[model samples]
Target chain A: MIQDMKPEDIIGDYKETLLDLYGSICRVVLYTDIETPYPDGKLIVSTTDKNGIITHVNKSFVEMSGYTEAELINAPHSILRHPDMPPAAFKDLWDTVNRGEKWQGFVKNLRKDGGYYWVKATVIPNIRHGEVVSYTSVRRKPSRTKVDECIKLYPTLF
Target chain B: MSYLFTVSPDFTPVHLSGWYIFNTWLQRQSGSPIHLEMYNDFPTQRLAIHNDQVDLIFANPFDAAMLVREKGFLPLVKAAGVSDEAIIAVRADSAVEDVAHLSPGITVAVTEDPDVTMMGMIMLEAGDLNAGNVETTIFDTYVLVAKNLLNDSADVGIFLAEAYDDLSSIVKKQLKILVRSQISVIHHSLMVGPKLADRRDEIQALLLSMAEDDKGKDILKSLGFDNWVKVDDEDMEFMIDLMEALAT
Candidate 1:
């Protein structure tokens, strides 16, 4: 449905308000136990504006998310955010990136088909002239041991 | 959250420490954590602005257009009685005495200060010259542009008028100005982004009264300003519109 909508229809002037509305507008959760293994030796890369609006995503990212470019551009990065993720992990990620630092974690991401995949995500602030501009995120296949640790650790924190 | 503040990179070296002092004063005055970040060039600074890293800025007329129109930044104040103008110069011994005498294919050296470059190009129109006709080389700073002229690497140089005035007497002596822009309406302005919009009135009032005190006067002198004055919204809009026209 979002793909049928014009880009301008979803990209509004107020970024904060739109980010707040993304959950309700874009949520189509039909979760299954199907787990898609991360592609080998490939990176899923994406960049987002300071307000978390998706500016660019690589081919690997498009293939992994199973979404077309039209559905991703101007969409909030949170569209791929999994409901199973703990709030504390994201809070920590935001804190680190906001301080102009890099944050790395094993993340569970939701695919278009409501399947899930795990990634070793490293997010870095793209700075120019000593100012943090946008953010770049590089995701790779995560270690199964680390994913197993997170699967147990995330539940206690929540 | 600590807000980032920056000035246009065209400032002369003498005022570097003055900006630090001003930052200190502003933090104390506003009771907010403000950090000053200076870029060495326009492209890098513009990249930062494009990413929305800048919360407060003292920006040139050309950049002010993008900031106000596209980025939702509000003009807070401007240097009283000061305007941004461009100057076209050559080495004193050079045969070129007037802009009309300038020939095509002359190597023109310039910094990436957009407003000054725009004005310089407009002045070159008198010689029936345009960007296509002239060979232009971009330097990182006005000093480098001057160096290019003095070393015979460039036939002409473009400079910000204020920066030209701040040049040492020795450097000024070797340079001959063909023309200077007298458009007094365009100016650099301090603007606040949406993150700091709530404190806009408070910050504006603080800067307006700064010259009334001895401490603020000293700081203003170090920064080569007499005082900060309120910029009329209509005046700023007019300037931005003018810049948009020139850019197109």
Candidate 2:
């Protein structure tokens, strides 16, 4: 089992490499079903390119997403975007991280085979040399109450 | 997508507009867009820094000194050439010709600007006059100081050496410097947050090369600066010392 730790809990840099065009998100699927609950004390770490392409994922993340390393290595981060997840939530995420600030929110991500999991994720600017080269995200099991609150508020962002 | 570019609120909005060209150029060079921000008060800007709401700032000496000492901000670059100083100017026709000839109780106009205030204080001290010795009127900017001085509201104007340069020609002919500040006037610092430290070399290179580009020359001219050079830590230290003295 991958060590039950946070990304900050992991020592040293988490490496990933995915370079997609800045924007190429066309798939929009919203499933009505709210699926499995992410367990306590588990963190899913992922890194994205400047364009939000999935470049790297930790073992815990891979197991949770049910995608092999090859399936996610160059996919858009939106591949994990869940339908019930509010667009406003992601908008807030972009707004915060775009300003080079860290943003934390409840995210509901989809799996490769149509399963889903909810997490409270923190996105930090991976700034190198006064510029944001990419973003590093660490997601942990979120409380049911907080996820419920976000679920109620997410759709209003659109 | 864009970084907040804050300037001291001590400057009026009209004055703040002067950085548009430079800010745009920086956005292009750094690959980060910029949101222009200015404050009417220093404390508000200080709060933004504490909150990490600012990525870069064009700060006056006093505030810059405080931020550098307190925050982990990196002083990236400064204007390339020309000396920045403060001066005590009198109406050309005034009988008071120099610092030594002035007597106590004469009114002097100065801004609350840290740079102007510090320089004025230093020059006043040199003339054996402190705030107690003179009737001082503090405005928000040196431009206001010059206005009050010309209107006969004050006997002397204490302002930036460059403000005198920007004056209307007729206004220019009406004032003469009675005392120039020898105290090292702190240069403007283009500072970056700690998060940007890794990109220091890239930012510095872009700034240093700004004047070399054809379009950059125009931008620099409009901003009243010639070029940008890597920051000098000695000057940074002096500014810190100045602020420290003020605190004590």
Candidate 3:
């Protein structure tokens, strides 16, 4: 009897199912945070097109980078790139992301005041029909040992 | 009497001969024929234990550690001798002369299994090498990693002790050992399920007493055994420390 529903009704039921799935995923996200005390410290989530123009920045990113959403949304992600970072690092990162493999690394980005901070970042390429639609990144504070090691090496790589 | 064993493609003929000797020894000691069933992999052996098909097993140290921690099994004796020598090999022509010289952009090839790869990571941690900077590529086999290094497909390769004998010649001629770790002993152990805890003393006595027999001596010699020693809780503590350290 449920299968005999009208198309509109079926679509509405499908929407509800999707909303339930999304809600379940959100619950999982909340559970993970509760389980670990070392919550992901901060995140700078941004979407970029093929040409690397920034399409979005979450509020956390705006606050962390010391930029408003308006100043960042249309800007290139390189606006925050640290001068001490070697071009080869970004080149390799882009190459990995473009190939649709997730790239993970400790990156140093310059804040608006020219001071720098490090993040352990994972970049995932979003694709549709073999074409990359955008890139998304999740970042968090790395261990102090990790940050210290990268800080000592980053200047030499330039 | 029922016994369990694991068989792998990598098992040498001598390993098979050891099993025969074990079976003969068990029969002589118990005054009855023991039925032996071999599992081809650790997963199957684990399942057999879960299903109550096997009472005892020879498991890899890592697997045995998991079984002990997760299933509360008691380890009886260590079978395979332990060694802590992992090699980080770089091509003869490469610029990396030491672990400190290993640059960020250079690719380091490692074996795919985390059990094997963790040895390299441990060495890296000890050497204060930052893994975040190095490009790490994982191969299914250490030999394949060596081949990749020889072929210039990767800049560095890490090989465990088992792979050393096969890779040494190539390494000496075409590659250099940038780092050699201190020998850390990691033994493969014979384990018994929780059901056999009551019989622990008898089982330990049986294993320790085997060395007194001529047949046991022959089996031990053939299997490269020195002698079976009593295992204590202290012996297992290292494994616990290693597992905890690696988990982080």
Candidate 4:
């Protein structure tokens, strides 16, 4: 359900919580022009339950997200899901993964510092005993060209 | 009317035929026309459950929460004296003798079993590994997870203890178990949705008494169980709460 709502509508309460957690200096709920550079030769990885709650995060993921291990654990993955991303794109992603397929795309992720980072993400369903219990998402640095194409394409989708 | 029955997808590949055999026996015992449909993945099976297509299911501990709480599935039976656990293993020759010796940027292979993965990841903390420092690859089967380790595709592997035990001796020889979880309360259970609520007691009785007969004993062996036992609602609830706690 949170997937369909706009960021402004969803982050209002969340923003207040962040403000309380880190005081006014914490601007995680706000969008900014800053871009967190994806480290070269490193992959950011995380796993989530079927509902998209973060179950595990690699160090690269922690560094890129700007959130401590405690804050990110059990948090909805949508915390990093950027508003600039068209809802349709996410809808497509959900549909594909739910169908037990891998989904590949460039994502604009919101960091805890309010900056954003682009990633070439591959989400694969981990199926055991013929059932998908969770998802493992492996993300790497997206090429500048692909990021640019998504920046143009996502707007049209909106 | 006829009803639908299914099992969790994570059953050992060797037991593929056992489910069919049991389904046939169930039809005879219940005196009803029940169709068995085995879903290959959780999403499709969950969709089936969501659409009310499944009347009976033998579900894992994680999926049991949804069945009992969301879908009104009642606990019928669970395997006797069995609990699900996770084991962390590495290639026997790998230099990382202890989990603490492992470092960042290591690739960890795993499957979709949530309870196992949750336990596996928790165990990795000894080595200071988390999602951000280690790369994770999700394989479709435990055999693939073993293959990934054998071929040196992954530095470490998280396996369901049962699956790890089922691996060929040659594969097990090349690998060394780093750790195994001993949480003994959690396990899979056979449950019946609201549609089959009326037959709940009868089915439970049938399952619990299966060991009394030779044929039933054979079926039990095929499914990798000694016998079926009644599940205490409170114990199931506790496991569900534990799963929720671990997942977060």
The residue ranges of model 4 lying beyond 4 angstroms of the native Cα positions read: A1-158
Model 3: CA > 4 A from native: A1-158, B7-16, B30-54, B79-81, B104-114, B126-141, B166-172, B183-185
Docking class of 3: incorrect
- The residue-by-residue lDDT of candidate 1 on B106-203, one tens digit each, is 99998888888987886675565679999999998888899899999999998999888878899999999988766566688999998998889999
Query: What count of clashes does model 4 give?
Result: 14
- Tens-place lDDT digits, model 2, residues A1-158: 01111233222333222312125434533232436666432447677888788877777778888668887788777777765665667778888989988787778886654557887677877655478877777665555556677778877765
Q: How far is A47's C-alpha from truth in model 2 (Å)?
A: 49
Report the lDDT tens digits of candidate 4 across residue range A1-158.
12222354332233322321111122234666678766543457777889888988878888888778887889777778666777677778789989998787789998766678998777877665478888777775555656778888888887
What is each candidate's fraction of native interface contacts (fnat)? 0.00, 0.00, 0.00, 0.00
Docking class of 4: incorrect
Categorize the docking of model 1: incorrect
**Candidate 4, DockQ score (0 to 1):** 0.02
Reference-based lDDT, residue A39, model 3: 19
Candidate 1 residue spans exceeding 4 A from truth: A1-158
> For residues B1-248, could you state the per-residue lDDT of candidate 2 as single tens digits?
56788876655344455687678888888888778877677778888888988888877777775676667677878877744577778888889775656677888887767666766665554344668888988787667787787889998888777776677788878888776643333567888877676877888889888888889887877777778878855456544543443321
Candidate 2 chain B minimal-lDDT segment of 10 residues: B239-248
Q: What is the lDDT ranking, best to worst?
A: 1, 4, 2, 3
Clash-forming residue pairs, model 3 = B84-B184
Best by lDDT: 1
